[model samples]
Target: MLDHEVNRFNGIEIEAAHAPEDPECFAGELAAALAAWEEAGRELVWLRVPIERAALIPVATAAGFRFHHSQEDYVMLVRRLRPDALVPHYATHYIGAGGVVLNSRGELLVVSERHRRSARPYYKLPGGALHPGEHLVDAVIREVREETGVHARFEALVCFRHWHGYRYGKSDIYFICRLTALSDEIIRDEREIEECLWMP
Candidate 1:
């Protein structure tokens, strides 16, 4: 185990144990290291665990570490050792984009999903998941067009919400973008979207 003390960031970066050793022993080592860090006044610690080394997950979880986020290659685990930590921990972060579109007639655009896992259908803003490597603005525009079949111009970032234990057991960052409809024509993906309407 190696510690990269990032004093400037007010945190320490710890690498997951990768010596091909017993997991129980490593768990104890990790716990001890965490204690040492806390004693040293370190405020935060981050551990990057590759997907293949999933065995280490139990070790970190047992040590009170929480999930932060995950990429295609690895999962990020975080622990807040002290209350004054500068950065907040959000494990497995997901980004979703939606558009709050208004037409010239002062009507709002809304959509209903054709099929969902929930008990009943829910109408919401026309939007969906952002594509990998896609910009937030671009994602919202694309999602709006796909779901509502309307071309819209993004005006501003209206708001966002942080959801814990969201869909698929992942933390979600939901973006509500303000938009102005460029065209009144409404088109929607019939397979995924059941309805699109202009509401007051």
Candidate 2:
């Protein structure tokens, strides 16, 4: 539990509890905390519960807590105790783009980074994060060229995913795009890309 005197809020952080436990135990504690906070004239009560603790969600909701937002491993819930308190809303913060380029011979364009921090090297699609003020279509086209040294035409947006618990500790907007290659020749960014390949 943390006390934010500056914000006039009491924050309760709940970790995952193993099963075969009682939800009533947590509910009782939450009830007591709510009563105390109400009596103290606090503006808000914040509860951070990890997604793994699926069991605690109902207990919190039953106490009038509303979903705020999720980051990394925790989902934040809040209960407003004051009418004048301000609450923040969600916004899109990051954009990541990649392309799935296939050749006439039914091969896919893939690349491996030189400085990957993982235990094993994993090949990825030929694309990356967008530059400042860059459009999504332009970003995908530029990334494919930079990583594979091949010119590609953006066809359509294949799919996109929202990544939480990412390495950078921020939400990521990952866009998977479909593109057609203009050339067979492969040139790679030596500083970022280690190898480029056309895999079946």
Candidate 3:
């Protein structure tokens, strides 16, 4: 039988490490595992298959597993044992911040991306996706420094925008934060930024 661990929802998780190498062996063990789990009153089953063992995909799918989500190294599949089983969704939203930086002279800091797809130079507030566990205030200030070498401090939240159909079918929430510039120098990042300057 395939070894599995119980999740918080009392679901069974068959990790990649415990999957059998041979597809035939995996199918048999998976069948047995399903029967056992059903008897144990399990409502849901999660299967994580590594890219290296992609051959087991068809076998698992044939046994009623459906694609849930995918990561760089593994594919997550799910099986609902009960009719009304609730499977937690993958990350549904992405959070980011844009900095509305203003200098003492009332000039606003803006940037044009180097790799923009649009014909016209896309000029906007300097900002980017927040790193995991990074606060919105810290992310805005950091983005300003990274895109255009300007030191800034958070003033207030100016505005925010939310839109669906963003990257990877996930919705995005972009916060516009007001920041006061402490430095006057304009040093743009060459990799992602093409032109950065203080706009009136």
Candidate 4:
């Protein structure tokens, strides 16, 4: 078992604990330490536990803590020090390059990449690379409009996957799913896009 203290961006002090061998035992200790921190005027307590060793979840819930979000190697849970006056901080990260999946009815909108000389043709979603200093959402909207000629609004973040190859410079990629209303109007730009259509 190990413990550490850290400060959040909102100035709240957090106490975190981890146990490699016995998660149940560490959960009890973590609850106790969190109570102590709360008594000392800390605003919240953060916890990290492996998804496989999820026995700590019940203990934390019994101690009034709730699950937050999980990313990479950490799963964070928190208990608010000020129950009625809690305000969460929103931190946005650019999702590198962005692409959109437009689901209309039961079909997905896709674009056909034109064959250059003797190269093979390929199919892909309508989106493109992000410009410098552009947010992921804004970049996605711009790319979709530029490629497909349809205005769009962001609905939800569905899934992300990486694309790796020599042509793309072996960079990590992010595929974003967005829901937008469909229209019959077609806007085609010859330079960057070849053709667009809806397919199952």
lDDT of 4 by residue, 1-200 (tens): 23665575332433333353465776667667766666767676666666665666677678777777666755677778766636464333324534554555656667665544436666777776677678778888787777777677777777887755524244456757575735535586678667787676
Cα lDDT of model 3 by residue, 100-183, tens digit: 899999999999999888989968999999998999999999999999999999999988999999987899999999999999
Prediction 4 TM-score vs. true:
0.44
C-alpha RMSD for every candidate: 5.3, 11.4, 1.9, 13.7
- Extract clashing residue pairs from model 4: none
User: Whose lDDT is higher: candidate 3's or candidate 4's?
Assistant: 3
By TM-score, the candidates rank as: 3, 1, 2, 4
- Relative to the unseen true structure, what is the C-alpha lDDT of residue 38 in candidate 1, on a scale of 0 to 100? 88
Q: How many backbone clashes does candidate 4 have?
A: 0
On lDDT, the stronger of 1 and 2 is 1
- Output the number of the TM-score-best candidate: 3
Give the lDDT of residue 172 in candidate 1.
Answer: 88
Against the true structure, what is each candidate's TM-score? 0.57, 0.55, 0.89, 0.44
Candidate 3 colliding pairs, count: 0
User: In model 4, where is the ten-residue run with the lowest total lDDT?
Assistant: 9-18
Model 1 weakest 10-residue run by lDDT: 14-23
Runs of candidate 2 with Cα error greater than 4 angstroms are 1-92
